[model samples]
Target: MNALVPLPVLLPLCATGLSLAFGTRLKQFQRFISVAVLTAVLGLSVALMIAADMNGPLSVHLGDFAPPLGITLVADRLSGLMLTVSSAVTLCVLVYSLGQGMADRDEETPVAVFHPAYLILVAGVSCTFLAGDLVNLYVGFEIMLVASFVLLTLGGTGPRIRAGSTYVIISLFSSMLFLTAIAMTYAATGTANFAQLAGRLAELPLGVQTLIQGMLLTVFAIKAAVFPLAAWLPDSYPTAPAPVTAVFAGLLTKVGVYCMLRTETLLFPGNRLGDLLMAAALASMVVGILGAVAQTDLKRLLSFTLISHIGYMVFGIGLATREAYGGAIVYVVHHITVQTTLFLVAGLIERRGGTTELTRLGGIAKAAPVLAVLFFVPAMNLAGIPPLSGFIGKLGLMRAGVADGSVWAWILVIGSTATSLLTLYVMAKVWNLAFWRAAPPGQAADGTVLESDDDSDDDTDEGPDRMPGTGDEGVRPRHEPAGRAVAATLHGHAVTTTTRLPRLMTWATAATVALGLAYTVFAGPLTAYTDRSAAELIARVPYVEAVLGR
Candidate 1:
């Protein structure tokens, strides 16, 4: 039983190693390995969740070493829930990537690098969730950063390189901050084990505690892309290939949020930065949604909304109640599936329409109703439409805020509601422009918008200015190149030359949508589990005892 605890992290690392060892020769086998490994990890996660629920926070001391010294991997309710959700999400994304890889078989960015790097990324996420010490957690974060840098720059497009550079520099800066905090922590307490830190951090002076807390939260904030720190995300994420962007948007930022939850509840239970967190949450929601509202490109719009929704999680953290934390947990799981599905759908949109620009995309509803539905389901879920997981999660958070009954919480309540409304409006706008409208002027029957069309000047003259940074020096416009497609329009569809979206990609995306819906179906049990998880997090003693064996 104890042996199973490390498998989630170990399996991915082994998969990555095998992928690397095989290199390009076994590329086909690597895909099968990726799926099998992630599926196995998902089963293990489900087992972990059940076992943790039954026995309370099962743990393993690596190499038979004990607490505050040896490596540890624990799957309490919180970590188990995260592992399960993340495993499910990563598996969906892995299938999506396989579809992408198979479809564009000869596309730049070696397939050999993709499987190993992606598996390593999964390992990092699993390690981050399972780590029982701050140092191990830091290692996980670094592993993720390194893998992400490769994934981000995969195609080596000029824009991808520039965007990847920004992402790497930001990741490194945040990492330095995290490492500095770890140093301060170890120097202050002489131990890095989470259980030990929980007991010892309080022994430091109030000022010292606050200082350390501020530094650590700032580091996480950068990783999480909370408010001011979020400016880098919208530009950076959209440049990657569809599958990479989807996984990064869904999983990476949440890892930071995960760490924040651990630090706020376990190590620094007082939550000295409550007001700061609340303020940042409000700022992120309002600012991010507003940015989304202005974006005319599908990917950029989603990227902005990603930043906005992080505010919701941070808001729940600010409230610091069990209900609020549970709500955040629920929201995190829902968002992971829903957001990833949307980006995968975006890939389909780009493939079929030859672009994701609102001005350039059209006739998706007519050309591929499946694409429209795939995009619509998750868009509605993301906007918090009723009877969906998004609604359930948001309702939980709103109720928690009301139950807290603080003036600031109420203010955030209002902010949350407004953000939801704006989110809906944004999705509706996307529906209108991308699915409902006729093809853009000069759109060829093959879905290619003629770049040099006589009406091209008319487009700029007629519509709002293109986004400022969107057209900056290095960035490629969201529209893919208009390859040599014969030009003609018929019956309101401009995409006569549309490439068929890969069936594998579509099915993978559809399955993810189903996964998001499943959260609504299983909300009762999931929420109950989260409630228990939040209680364990807040109580902290069981975790300590589980680790200390006292």
Candidate 2:
């Protein structure tokens, strides 16, 4: 079992290589293999979490060589928790893609590459969380970026290609900055391993330590999409395939936030940059929500909301107390599950209704009732509705802010609450346009009707194949019942219409909703694990001892 510690990272890397070797000839096998590998990794992550919770940190050194010489995979409570969540989310996304026929041979070449590239992305995320050293973490980031670049440009559509170019450039620039930071840290501290860096960092003068901290934070902030550096996120995330967008939404930004938490609490104790972080956090919250409110596209709105919520995590980091850090840890776990679910649900809407543009979509509640419920639950949770995981996370941060009694913290509390309200507004905008409004005249049963030649033959079109609105001009529209009634009416109205969920898509949505509920039910234990993880991170003593024994 101990030997299996590196399987999560290795399995994906191996799969990537095999997929490349086989090319598109064995796409089905690639999908099956990827799913099996991820499933096994998910199981391992759960086992690791249980074992680490019962024991202490778990470590497996490569080639039986000790740390400082060979690579090591360490699974403390935090790393284990993140690995579990990330793996599960990736698995759900894979299921969703299979449902969308994205993994099928009929898909375009770039889209066909998703299975292999997504596996590589998962490996990178797993490595990032499990890595025991700074250089390893940087390697993980680079691998993830390369995989993401391919996934983002799947289909090679004009919009996707344009957005992807910007994404690639920004990601490459940030990676270079990260490499520079790692190099500088190694020079200053004479060690690249995190545990050793902690000890070495403590020995340095406060000024020098602050400089290193600044460099590291700048690099991670670009990854995390923090304010001023966050412009790229809103533009890039909305253009990808829904399944890819879901995984990116749930895992990518959190990876950056995870790095920040580690650096602030573990590498730089008694850090004085809290105030600067506070300012940045506030800006992110305000600016992100504002952008969300102005968006008409469902994906873009959710993208903006993502940036807004990141501020709360950073707010916790700024407080720099055990309670604050603990809250941040739990919040990170909560946000990952919720954010990914929301994005996946968005994908479902796009698939069922044929368009993600709110202005063009309506009455999805009538067509996909189950999807409506799925999207609604997470939407409310993200708006911080009481009793849900999102509300609990925000409440924890607010309570910590109150207890700390810092003026900036108090402002963050108020700002986060306001952002929540605005987030609700943005979500409501999507809900109203997608679920509440009536389908326009001569439009397909699902709000969108083909008016142009370009839209007529679109694969997403589901209505009668007759010429546009011409057939509808002679016939008067009949009043249809609302909600479930509409589904029954649609059935009676168009017996020949195809409107069933694909088996894989159904499973994917179920899995995502189940994960959200699981987080809510298991919140107590999860939070407890995160608390222990936060405590260990803040102290850094246990980690240092483990890596460089006494």
Candidate 3:
């Protein structure tokens, strides 16, 4: 089983090479390889999860070389769980993208390079989860960075280019900080291995330890989009193609949070910066949701909510108790699936409504009852509706907070409740405007304006403005009057657009929605698992002794 530790990282990477070699020449084969690889990875991840739980942490030194000089990967409960969830989510996204490609005739993701880049992204995510040292973790991030840039700019459209540039710059800055921190760690302790550092870092002076901790936390915070560092995300994410956006929103920030969880428990115990973490959590929850409340576009609104919910996880970490950590773990898993499902639903909404603007969308419930159900279920779950995993996770965290009985914990408890309510308000607003309201008289079911009844060539020069970060920077007024535009275009000329939802895309999204509900069905065992995972993380000895073979 220990020998299997590196396969999750290696499999996708090996498949990536094959994917690229096949390239545009073999599209079907490329799709097959991508799906098959991720599916295998997901299965392996589940196996690893069970094995790690039953047998303690699993570690394998690459090429039979010991840790200080060779690459090492460890799959403990945390990593195994993360690996499983991420693999499942990425696999679903890949299927969705394939359906999208077929539906759009490959125009949306025009390049065949998408498969290779996506596989690379999967490998990178797996690598981070299993990384045994700071340097290896840094490598994982870089791998993701390269692949993400390609995916973000897939179409090379203006908005995508601009958004991709911003994403790349922020990622680069964070990477540099991460690398610098790694160097500093190696300089301070002569080894970059996590298990070795756990013992050695304890011997350092209090100030040095604090400084290093601050550096690492800052790097991860930026990656995790915590409070002040999160401003780039809303602008960066909404511009990409829907599938790209879905996977990214689900996985990337959580990787950062996972790092924070691991280091906080194993390397920097006692929660030296717990107060600061709590403050960030408060600001992230309040500020991020307020941003969500102000958005009129569905995707941007979801992006802001993503930042806000991240605070819940951060709050759990700041509490630094077993229950809090467990709650955080559960929330992380819930958010990854729920958030991804919402974005995919957003794609379906866009497909049916022709745009994501709340002002223009109406009567989706009447037009496509299925799409409305897809959107509503995940939207409500996101708002922490009872009996859903979202509520279960938040309730646990709040309980942990109250149990702590600290003033800050109490404040975060209030903040968490408030955030949940605001999230509900935002989702309800979307529901009211995008689904319940009646469609305009001249508009088609898909939001396109139809021909005027009267034969008037007169144009009203009225239309919706383009969303920021979605290209078309300058607003182009509609040449037709309110009831006269056709195909929902910026210009007077009409262009053909697909009105029917793709079956494959819809079914893929339904699969994700089902996965989210599965959490609710098995909430008992899931929370139990997270609780045990949290305990293992806090103990720290299991990981250290397993890695060092002591």
lDDT of the candidates, in the order given: 0.83, 0.77, 0.86
Candidate 3 residue-wise lDDT, 248-287, digit = tens? 9999999999999999998899999999999999999999
| Candidate 3: 10-residue stretch with minimal lDDT | 484-493
Model 2: per-residue lDDT, tens digit, 435-534?
8776434333434322221122244534343214333342222222111101111011111122565567767877887877776788787677777887
- Candidate 1 lDDT, tens digit per residue, 288-327? 9999999988889999999999999999999999999999
Sliding window of 10 residues with minimal summed lDDT for model 1 = 484-493
TM-score for each of the candidates: 0.91, 0.90, 0.92
RMSD, one per candidate, in order: 6.9, 5.7, 6.0
In TM-score terms, candidate 1 sits at 0.91
Return the candidate ranking by TM-score, descending.
Answer: 3, 1, 2
Per-residue error for 171 in candidate 3, Å, reads: 0.6
Q: On lDDT, who's better, 2 or 3?
A: 3
Q: What lDDT is reached at residue 60 by model 3?
A: 88
Q: Which ten residues in a row have the lowest lDDT in candidate 2?
A: 485-494
> Any runs in candidate 3 off by more than 4 Å, and if so which?
107-109, 441-497
